[model samples]
Target: MPFIDLRAQYAALKPSIDARIQRVLDHGQYIMGPEVQELEQALAAYVGTQHCITVASGTEALLIALMTLDLQPGDEVITTPFTFAATAEVIVLLGGVPVFVDIEPDTLNIDPTQIEAAITPRTRAIMPVSLYGQVADMDAINAIAARHGGLPVIEDAAQSFGASYGGTAGTPRESGSAPRGKSCGLSTWGATSFFPSKPLGCYGDGGALFTNDAALAQAAREIRVHGQSQRYTHTRVGVGGRMDTLQCAIVLGKLERFDWEVAQRLAIGERYQRLIGDLPLQRLAVREDRDCVWAQFTVQVDHREAVIESLKQAGIPTAVHYPKPLHRQPAYEARSRAATPLPNAEAAARRVMSLPMSADLSEAQQDQVVAALRVALT
Candidate 1:
């Protein structure tokens, strides 16, 4: 079984994908072509955001978001250490400090209550990661940010682009009665990846920044093209972060069936949750207000390495979304400032493992995985 099954996805969307790619080639505007704007507009409408700025990579998306915020040296960005290094790596790259906060033991997302205590005069932003396709406590985090000088909150939504948050228009959406806003539209800034494994992936490296703030959106646009306010005018220090036209074309093709794909992901994720209920593993918690797109259908198991090896032997593929927390990494340990205890993040790193997951995953395949896991634990 493929860990992510990107081949299957490509096969399913072959015709449109081919057409989109062909159109891009015919136009010969490889860099910043019409397809780029086409994708930005489409995704912006889908995400319910005022602006969508495509970038070269997910890392570049985060970096550009921070650059637009004008994060200065010694400034702090509060975030969870339990996510991909990119979450905190961007902060450190800007000559800023990454204030690490522990995650909820159940959700494995940044604990919102732990955020305020980590704030200081140096705090410039609060970044919460939507891990394994589940959103963090965004409403609570937003409230905290509002109480503290209206600090910018960036949602590291790389894994949760199709996911929805519970609240909309100052109303709670826990009951599912009200419409839920999409992940990228819920924060001051939402950055998502288009890596092949993500819920909404492009053929190559790509990402998008979403926001409602016009000034911030304009700054991101400028920063994306070598900080050019106009042609060849370097208004500020910026990186070459613009997503290529070809990659944008690929994403637009994928969007043809994205809604169906998201629905499939939701059903698959829910089925996996049900199938594994009796297994000797702890399933990641899903809040009632939101849904996971199953970017990685992860679960916590004892003897995680042994489980992985057993699955591998049974012709089943598995992976750890992150084997080590960023704070424990050699590069980030010294650079991170932790105000909350990291015991949960530490324990989660050792126990957490992701199962084979994709919108195209089948029930029989899921059952085979569960049966193998059941035997492995025995």
Candidate 2:
């Protein structure tokens, strides 16, 4: 069985995807066509945001969001060290510092309790990553940000596009409540990816930004197009960050079944958890109010290498979400600002393993994975 069953998804949506692609082909305005705007509109509506600016990639989406905020040479962006490099890469790329914070042991997300201490006069923003398809602690993070002059909170929703955070860490807020709300529409800026394996992925690289602020949305729109206010008019320094029309078309097709896919992902994740309850390994924590889309159905286990090998021999695929904390990476070692040791992040790095997951993942496949894992652990 494949790790992520994209072929199954493609087979399910082949007709719509083919027709969408054909329409784009006939138009031949591949650069910035009508489909782009259509996708932007569709995504904006889906995410309950006023604006959705499609970008070339998830990294670009993060980079553009920071650029729109006008990050400066000594500015610091508070973020978790337990995420993909791109979460911190964008900060360092623009000459800003990445202030590393520890993650919660249960959710593997940034610890909101440690955030305020990390904030300083040079801090420009708070970037919280929604890891493993579940949103981080946004309520406490946002409250801290608001206390400190309303620092721009950027939700790195790359893994959590469809997930909602109804404040289980605290009281259960309404669907769109302040500070504790949906993932992409929760904070000052929401950036997500479509890396062909995400819950709502397209065929190739694509991503979008979400915001309710019109001025910031306008700034991001300009920044994506080389900071141009008009055609060939360079107003500010920027990058070529527009998502191609073809990719937009693919995303449009994928959006048709996105709601159903999210439901399947949640159901499959629950089923996996229930099936694995009797096993010795520790399952990932899905909060009471929020759901994980299970971009990767991850669990913590001991003797990880041996278990992985055994699973491999059983014809079951497994992968790690991330194996190293950003602070330990050679490129980021000099830049990380870890006030306290990241024991949880480091522990999670060594133990967490992701099983084969997708909306199309079958019960038999899930049982195979669990049985293989049981044998591997034993």
Candidate 3:
């Protein structure tokens, strides 16, 4: 049993993918072809954003967003410690500080209530990671940022590109709960990954930045092209961060059924939640106001190592989204501002385990994973 099942996704989208690839090959403008802009436009529309700038990778998307904001040597970016290193790495790379905050126990997202207290004169931005395919409290986060002299809020939506937001947490379902906004559309800069394992991914490394602010969008566009306002013009210091045409073509093909795929992911996640409800494990909390795309069907369990081994014996695959909080990591321990104890983040790190998940994952495979967990725990 494969962990992600990318091959199955490829097989399903082979026709469109092949034709798109062939078109790109025939054009031979591989650097920044028409497909790149086409993809950017398509994504902008889908995400309900004014501009979508495709970048070389998600890390580049973060770096460029910071660069576009003109983050300084001592500038601080508030973020969660319970996320991939790239979330904090980008801030440190640009000579900026990452102020680590605790996360909510239920959703594993950065706690919004803890953010304002962390803000200081040096704070330049608030970056919240939409960990494991669910958005954080953007409405409240944005409100906090607004109170702080209009600080930029960047959504590190690496795992949640297709997730929808705008439902109130701790509330009952509203009738016809239409999507209020997509992950990338709800912030000053929404950055998402196209890593193969993500909910909406291309074949290889790719990422994008979405924003409604024209100035910031233009800044990101120039920064992505080595700070060029025109050909061979270096207006500002930048990096090689443009997403290649081939990758854009592949992503375009994937979009042929992306709406359907997102829907499937949500349904599969709900079904998994129900199946594992009675199990001796803590399922991730999905708020009623929004939906999760289930980039990874993760859950919290005890004796994680033994359970993982038991699943392995049963021919089921499992993974940990992240095992260590960034503040506990060697590189970031000295760099983070631990204003308060990250009890929930620390606890989640020890228990969270991701099961094999994909749009192609079958119900039988899901049952097998649950049965293995039942045996493993016993």
What are the candidates' C-alpha RMSDs? 2.2, 1.8, 2.3
Model 3, which residues run further than 4 Å from truth? 167-179
At residue 241, give the lDDT of candidate 1.
91
Q: Considering only N, C-alpha and C atoms within 3 Å, which residue pairs clash in candidate 3?
A: 167-289
Alpha-carbon runs more than 4 Å astray in model 1: 167-180
Question: Residue by residue across 1-378, what tens digits does model 2's lDDT show?
Answer: 999999999999999999999999998999999999999999888778899999999999999999999999989999999999999999999999999889999899899999998888999999999999998877778888989999999999999998877753334865544654567998899999999999989888999999999999998899999999999998888899999999999999998999899889989999999999989888888777677888888999989999999999999998997999999999999976785679999999999999999999998988888888889988
Task: Quote the lDDT for 377 in model 1.
Answer: 84
lDDT of 3 by residue, 169-251 (tens): 23434444323688988889999999888888888899999999999998888898888999999888888899999999999
Candidate 1 structure quality by residue, lDDT tens digits, 148-226:
9899999999999888777532336546232358888888999999998899999789999999999999999999999
For candidate 1, the per-residue lDDT at 223 reads: 96
TM-score of 3: 0.97
Cα-based lDDT for every prediction: 0.90, 0.90, 0.90
